[model samples]
Target: MRVLELLEEIEEIVDTAAGFPLTGKIMVDSQELLEIVREIRAELPDEIQQAQWIKNERERIIAEARTQYEAVIEDAQKQADALVENNDITVKAKLRADELMRVTENTAKQLKIGTYDYLDSILYSFQGKMEHLSSIYFGEMFTSIEKAFDDINSALAANRDELKDMAYRTQMDADDIPAPSAESEEEDQ
Candidate 1:
């Protein structure tokens, strides 16, 4: 049933019970009410388990992306280093260092572009997966919230005896007087 309908039903029960003593068994059985609460507690672990699995998956994907990105960076650095170590083997070791430097620069630029392109594609794939999983997780979360609220309402509606017990406790608390302040005590003395 909708929330409004459920609330209206509870209100009707409360109105009907106004003609009787609040401590009577006319509303809910105390043992059964306790059982409902225990059932709710038991189901809580399942909800937590679902949340933990989603969290673990998200962390694992992020870690994998970081490892891949770092590996690509290291490989690019190694290639650039190798290019710089050339000693003009074709020129009998007589060529100017500037010639070798130009070749190394061009090779490094190409390797950088290639490495970054691969990383970008990997990042895009990771982002897509994250988005899809997040949507599914959030959808389940809302359903859980709705179910929780419904369960609470259902228990409250069926257990009028529990509500009366609470009401009496509230009345007792209100009837008891608080301790006098220091100023009031001094005035009495």
Candidate 2:
């Protein structure tokens, strides 16, 4: 979230920058840009940590569900064993134990299903946020930065070419100036 806000600030800076007349180039504060970029780098670890937390929480929930399932199964088995030990109502006890087992199994299945659905929803939401951030914010920011660098490189190359041309002309002009003869040098002496 802080990263998103920082990205928006960068966008605002670019949008508000003053452009060179007819050049399609804008001047930005390099210091501000660098500072915001540093902040973004700093915030990235926090985002990663949040993702790690989500994964840990999901695992914890799953473990809890498994523990509950085991506890329910154990309880159902103990009850069935106790019922079977009674020799007077063996038939009724066996039937009751079978019904209890079916109900317990169904409840365990539902609990597992519910746990999976909850984890899936959480993961789905996280995935959406990641997609939105990458596609909308990072994508546009990278494009703009790339274009700016390309413009800067073009301008620098043109300036270097102009300097080379000026240097060549200066050399040609020096060559054109005639050197004084020996007689002219003697007269000056």
Candidate 3:
């Protein structure tokens, strides 16, 4: 499941917990909470792996660009060789070949520059997306985790206060109860 969906589910779980009377306390099942946490842990690695895959894809694109550049250079060289076959029109052939070579070299240089620019833009886009994804997801996760911990802490503090209140009430009620006097105890004996 998506991280956002998991976060929503956890929020729902917390929202659905039974609230304690007159306190910021909610009762949550430990097993259910643990299972969701386990799923989140499982999802994190897959997200990281996806980032790795994008890096690999960038490298693959660069390699393909290099291959195309080499092929263009090679094809241009072959055409130049084909144009230089005869001694009859050697001067004309040499001029045409040189022109073709210059054009081919310029085109090759342009193609290389264009390829690098395109790849750089794509990689920059991917990097931006990765940065945004990490910031958003990690920020969400940290916010959720921090909220959950805060809620738990509030619940614990409330529980402690309730226990103290109960203990005090019990002690007061015991104090109010009548006890037999020493003379009554002696007469009874």
Candidate 4:
């Protein structure tokens, strides 16, 4: 976000800079442009770190879900075993244990699905911002800056593709549960 703000400042400078008569060229302060570019470079790492944090948070949530699932399965098994020892209600105990396992599995799946959706939404927003920057600033006078934006855009596209692949793999593993639709995401927004 800070990078975007700095970009807006750069845009303002360009917009306000004086232009030559009969040419499409404009004058801008090189030092001012360099300072803002430095600021943007500094802010870029923070954005990347935030993306990394999202990924770590997703892993943590999945781990927590697995732990809870295991705990519940263990508890259900213990209860079923105790009931089996008393031969009178073995059938009922088996049925209850199965039900518990099914419910626990469904809960775990939902948790994982929710985590993936949350991460997808965040990456989607970030991808949009990167695209916006690439469209607005590319092909300007700053060749080095254009290359930097190009690299950032490429990285973002790769990240987005990776996320999509992850979600697809997860969906296939989860019995083909449908992924959230873009329309639904837009509605939520």
Candidates ranked, most accurate by TM-score first: 2, 4, 3, 1
lDDT to native, each model: 0.53, 0.85, 0.74, 0.79
lDDT of 4: 0.79
Please give, for residues 1-189, the per-residue lDDT of candidate 1 as tens digits. Answer: 132233344334434532224432234333543444455456556645655665575566556655755665565555455555565543433243344445555655565566566656755665675576447543543454454456556667868878898999999998896878999999999
The lDDT of model 2 is 0.85
TM-score of 2: 0.87
- Candidate 3 segments exceeding 4 Å error: 82-138, 154-189
Per-model TM-score on C-alpha atoms: 0.35, 0.87, 0.59, 0.63
Q: Superposing all C-alpha atoms, what RMSD in Å does each candidate have to the true structure?
A: 16.0, 2.1, 5.0, 30.2
Q: Clashes in candidate 2: how many?
A: 0
**Candidate 3 accuracy as lDDT:** 0.74
Q: Residue pairs in steric clash, candidate 4?
A: none
User: What is candidate 2's lDDT per residue for 1-189, written digit by digit as tens?
Assistant: 799999999999999998878999987777888899899989999878978998898888778877877887788677767777678666777787778778777877887788789878988898898899889988998888777778778888989999999999999999999999999999999
**Model 1 / residue 14 / CA error / Å:** 10
Ranking by lDDT: 2, 4, 3, 1
> Relative to the unseen true structure, what is the C-alpha lDDT of residue 3 in candidate 4, on a scale of 0 to 100?
69
Model 1 scores worst on lDDT over the 10 consecutive residues at 1-10
For model 1, what is the error of residue 159's alpha carbon versus the real structure, in angstroms, after optimal superposition?
20
- Cα-based lDDT at residue 4, candidate 1: 29
